[model samples]
Target: MEIKLVPVRPEDKGTLINLYQLYEHDFSRFTNRDIDKNGRYEVNIDFYWEGDERWNPFYIEVSGTIAGFLVVLFENMDIDPDPTHVIYDFMILQKYRRTGIGRAAAIKAFKMYNADWAVTQMENNTPAISFWRNVIKSFKEDNFTERYRPERKKYIQELSTKT
Candidate 1:
């Protein structure tokens, strides 16, 4: 289970888009997301291509296989104002679920930044909530805050590695 987070290149945008479809499909269960007439869900990976230093995209590879993807967002990046590295998107294929690959990738992503972190999950997504809680707790013990944001309808876990 050698997990590596490879920085996604501009030429790999298509791969990211394809992987995003899967991520969105899985997320649709909790968000009730609907696809357009084209039979494809609209996802915004545009920010990753905006040449911003804050938006990072990575391909989660396990033993040279593309297992999933992760996007880390730095605060002050146009889309979000939170003062922390945000876990914008993360997904592991069905075959890789519950196998620790995702947890490993997530922890790797967190270690890439030495600042605070914010991991959010749709309010109805219990599995995501559990996954993030376990990962953050194992990474930083009980030094994080978990709160629900009514306006956004999501549960956000905020933690700091600086202290």
Candidate 2:
């Protein structure tokens, strides 16, 4: 299947918002998040299209169908810079998980920006940790480092894009 990362535009906010709700729903099991009176989870995706050059938002398309979403952040974008990128959020819809679509989308996202990368997962999210470990290993061999940040309760996987 052809996997494509279609940039999310301002007009496409609603689509991204809808997809984001599903993404958050998946996290409900691993988080203490509760729906509010609006019956919707709070989503903070407006920054992507708010003219922040550091944020990249895209819809992951598989065989011409919307399968997921990815948000990449240029690390330290507002500060003294370094060659780094961060996979802020990545999710493949429930129906597309384990179908290789997620892997394809991940690799594509990695290749999109020419810089070192950082991917983090919540400490309790073992599945995400495993998925990212496998994907990063496949893409970078043994060149990446995985470390746990106790204060943040997350595992961070860092790798260089340079060959």
Candidate 3:
């Protein structure tokens, strides 16, 4: 299956915003975040695109169709001097599940960033935990670390590219 991550552009904002709603819809099952009675979930999309140079968001495309989106940002969640690129949000359309598209997109992101990387899944999301564990395991095993951070209640996978 062909998969790609396209940098979301201004003209695509409307489409991305619409997809963001679905992302939140799926996340609700694993978190306490509330959706408004009107069925809207709050997010800072504009800020994500404008306010921070370190924040990057991409649209996941499967064979020329928008499948989902993910945010890869240079953040200090675990704090390392070498800089850390984190995959903050990842969503794949239900129609595209279990087809290796997510894996291909993630592997592309790893090569594109080519730095210390972090991917975290909320502890309650078992499917996510399993998916990420398998993905990390396929990479260079010597450079990866997987563990649950009790304070944040998140399962974290960190990849250190250092020799």
Candidate 3's residue-wise lDDT over 42-156, tens digit each?
8667877675667788999988999888888888633655578899889999988898888888888888865888899888899999998887788766668888889999988
* Decoy 1 TM-score against native: 0.92
| Candidate 1 local lDDT, 74-148, one digit each (tens) | 878566554578998898999999999999999998887778889999888999999999999998899899999
Give candidates' CA RMSD values in order: 2.3, 1.1, 2.4
| Candidate models: Cα lDDT each | 0.89, 0.90, 0.83
Number of the top candidate by lDDT? 2
Question: What is the lDDT for 157 in model 3?
Answer: 90
Predicted structure with the largest TM-score when compared to the true one: 2
On the 0 to 100 scale, the lDDT of residue 124 in model 2 is 97
Ranking by TM-score: 2, 1, 3
lDDT of 1 at 83: 58
Model 3 poorest ten-residue lDDT run: 74-83
Question: What is the RMSD of candidate 3?
Answer: 2.4
Question: What is the lDDT, from 0 to 100, of the residue 146 in candidate 3?
Answer: 82
Report the error of model 1 at residue 123, Å.
1.1
Model 1 gets an lDDT of 0.89
Better of 2 and 3 by TM-score: 2
